[model samples]
Target: MEHRFDLLGSGWVSVECDPKSYRLSSGNQKRALAIRQLIDSAYNPIDWQLDFKSGYRWRADRLSGTLRYGHEPAVDVKVPWELARLHHLSWLAQSGDEKSIREFRNQVLDFAAANPPGYGVNWLCTMDVAIRAANIIIAYDLFISQGIEFDEAFLGEFHALIVAHGKHIMANLEWHDVHRANHYLADIVGLLFVAAYLPCTDESNAWLIFSVEQMINEVERQFTPDGANFEASTSYHRLSAEMVVYGTALVLGLPKDKKAILGGKNSFPDWYFERLERMAEFCVHVTKPNGRVAQIGDNDSGRFFKICPSFDEAGGTFKEQHLDHRSTVAAINGLFEREDFEEFSGPDVALDTTVVSALAGGQKITSYLKPGDNPGAMGVQITGGVDSGLSVLAQTFIEPVDATVLNGLTVFSYPDFGLFIWRSSRFFMSVRCGPVGQNGNGGHAHNDQLAIELNIDGEDWIADPGTYLYTPAPNDRNAYRSVHAHAAPKIGDKEPSRLDFGLFRLENNVDARCLCFSPDGFEGRHAGYGVPLHRHIEIQDGKIRITDLISGTKSSKVIPRIVKDGTSLRKLWSLDLRFSPGYGIRD
Candidate 1:
């Protein structure tokens, strides 16, 4: 309550506005209530260095490495980072909640004091460092936009925090020699925010120029012409798309003098916006009739920002948390004003979409909601928002597609991402057959080549099992990512890909290919077992038929090995499936 307002953030120009003046359409009441709930919970308080999942409190004075995983609890560092993100504070400030606003400032000062630069578990991961910085900027910007003022002492401290995060990101970027995935992208995007807000010093401007150049190069390198993220996962597509959208928005809003630093272009070129729209198009297509994505690869339920609140933190609701992909869709739809995405996501999304539109300098958005409106006929009860994009977002690689319609539902294929989706009024099908992602490293991709996620009627009956957890829970992680967890063709004692290192990365030994693809059906194969294993899925009215064949092998001699203990032969393999709504929470 006593901290200086300027002590809140580094350099904020969009000040001198009124929170009372901030307004949203009455139709967005439900979403606004969600925002209130999220902020109210913030008062439940945050322990900046506590791993809520593991109940391990990180020592503030120790080096990040000094806190070993083998320590009691083998803590999940993300637990603290989640709350420390401070995104809820923006919603609080956005709503003109003065009490929560003061608490937001107080919490930041306390967090910085506890977790100084270069020490504590929060500072260990540069990606989290950058993400924290971005969230911090958003909250600070909103506060200042309301003409909130601060003392010089508080401003100095806040500026130091921004500089610290930027220095850490620059020093420890998540760059990979072969592929700069979402982690690297998070680094630059976070740095981009720091550069824009930090009073334009030489160091800050250097960060601006460097982040801009990296973003331009990576947009083309990371995403294919089809707009699918190279990460090979639907949830990840939402994740990466969020970062690209919000980060680009900030870049676009930069002054002409600042924008000119990008060589000659004032901002990202025409192609950048085109690809971004297509990225949203991918979201538009992959969504099932149930309002969730196909869950093509991994989905750990990661997000960039949370504008709404429906996610159960303990990961209680699997369908609610893991399967839902609406908020990200809503944000992108509103930001770009895509009627197509709005058609898929529905009009009620104005709740958070309006805020995103506000961030984009108030893009004109109209309501598409009627008295009775739902994404699907019986929409899944879900409410949430994503972090900039997940998220360490997902990827896969496949040869360019030769898509054709054969008197059936239209086929939407992401050739580079290796995803083939077929959608009609009541039936939706997505076939997962493609090369490995992360340059064949398959970092965020699952071993579900030739797999399929099916939705018939309004509800999701069969789907890919989501990522249960990572690193901390290796067995669960491996179990969820295994070929058995997906609806792919089964083989006797064969796995399409190896769970290399038994962690995030996978080996690309299996060659996934799309033999023939059309709206009528799909025929594809993988070279994982001894003989070429082929799977053909035929799209029929109100139904789908799947057929598996083994080439150059006798049915008798090459029969699958006898199975017991919850698993059967290829024909009957549902016995060993696992479903998880998100990381560390299973259903």
Candidate 2:
């Protein structure tokens, strides 16, 4: 087969190897099975179980269709369906199922016929277009690699689709002033993928340079020196980090001779890889024993690629299921050939060794963590040795810091991001006492300042009310970002930080500081609500205690909103409220 472009040298990529070599994890296989079943049943997996073909109006959870983007009803429907179709087809193509391949090809042709360039809801948001373009490229690559050939006309249409996507993204890139969040990152990644994988042309070359420059600049601007995503949202952190990984892989996977030609002046520097490694490590540190992360601020459950299934076997939604952070870490390990990262891999998470093996040469990849000299040297501080009785899951790649390192209460402070984690044998609590969002705009940030999430005995008790929707519904959007939605104290019905006019934007940057720290407790204060509000947290044995102190304001009524699951207002002396288990779900 003659190649039009060489993404990983002049050879043709193939998946005609042993199935075991590319096998996804059991959890991912379950998700793939679900997708396969949905396809076999002639049901679209992302219709939100609603009949879009009929006149049934689509609504975001309980939010009315009359709100926000409701004017363009198809905008919400197209993105998810496009994502589901691409993922379903990609999985089947990777598996080399002939019938599925035929179906996928037919679907691709059908979609192109139905939705022309810039005509459908799928093209409404440049971000969604970018996502679809990347997914199509990946699916097409997998299909060709599996020896499935398309007619020249089909190929022409596909290439034209790519061209249309590229022009759309270049013209409508999501660069709104200083609001460079995960959306902007995804746009550039899509452009880079299109630029690299497609045949070289003047426009493609220009896009390659422009995307590489923007990506490099965004990496430095969006992330702190400590590698924390400036948005302060764990879900967005993963999204942004994956974009970095994908961009890095695209560049590094190129032939050595073509490296200079592709990279040009905006070449990735040494610090870029180092920063990426640190970002992955940050994901590792923040992950809980149950394979879930702390939903610090707003969590929309956004993802870049879904090669492996992200579902758990119990049939829960995306938010109910745990995100496999280890998969991304494994890809990074394979990309950089860093044996040090092997400690972060485990059997429970899915591993795409095909992508890894293709990008990095065939190397023995293990799912077990091995002890090394100075294991703590990988960026995070470690102090304590493993206690024999601790569960294997509780034991992290970094050695458990000595209780004394906690100074007595096991507290880890990321001062750059103003994040503090306090842990005891039976409890874990995370406090967000930092600037409200990043880059002075807080584009992806919520208005939950000095909020906290608590976990007791591996069960989330007081938790963050996850972000329900973005931009589509105005009232629900504001409700989720309200002070009453978080586990924080509000003064006279006032928010600690001010929410800006745009979606997911917050202003009046809160000035917060950790005033005191000890082995048994932490003390912090913020002045975002026109008064100094202080919180003191103490954990002794299994008992948890929290105290709030407000100063500089008299006659100011303080209403504390403590969000907990499985409790009622009748049980406690407060008003009962519903919580969003995931994005677009409130219960």
Using TM-score as the measure, the top candidate is 1
Q: Which parts of model 2 are misplaced by more than 4 Å?
A: 1-85, 256-258, 263-266, 315-324, 336-345, 353-357, 360-410, 423-426, 516-519, 553-576
lDDT of each: 0.65, 0.58
Tens-digit per-residue lDDT, 1-587, candidate 2 = 11011111111121112212322334344433432332234422222212232223333222121223444432344323333225455666766676666566555654453344444345556777787787788778778876888777567767877888899899888886766677788899889878877777778888887888899899988877667788877778877887777676766565543455564433766567667766766676666555667776676656566565455445332323424566666666655545545666554333543564464334332322245532221323323322122111100011112323222335566656657776544456677777666676766666666667666556655567667666446677777787777766566577776665676577755787776655555667777777667766665543445656666434334344342332432123232346664555565
Off by over 4 Å in 1: 1-45, 70-74, 309-322, 362-408, 541-543, 556-571
Q: Best by lDDT, which number? A: 1
Residue 365's C-alpha lDDT in candidate 1? 30
Model 2 C-alpha lDDT versus the unseen true structure: 0.58
The backbone clash count of each candidate, in order, is 26, 7
Tell me the lDDT of candidate 1: 0.65
Provide the RMSD of all predictions against the true structure, rounded to 1 decimal. 12.7, 12.2
For candidate 1, lDDT tens digit of each residue in 116-222?
Answer: 67777788877778888988888787778778876665677678788989999999998988966888988899999899888767788899999988987888888
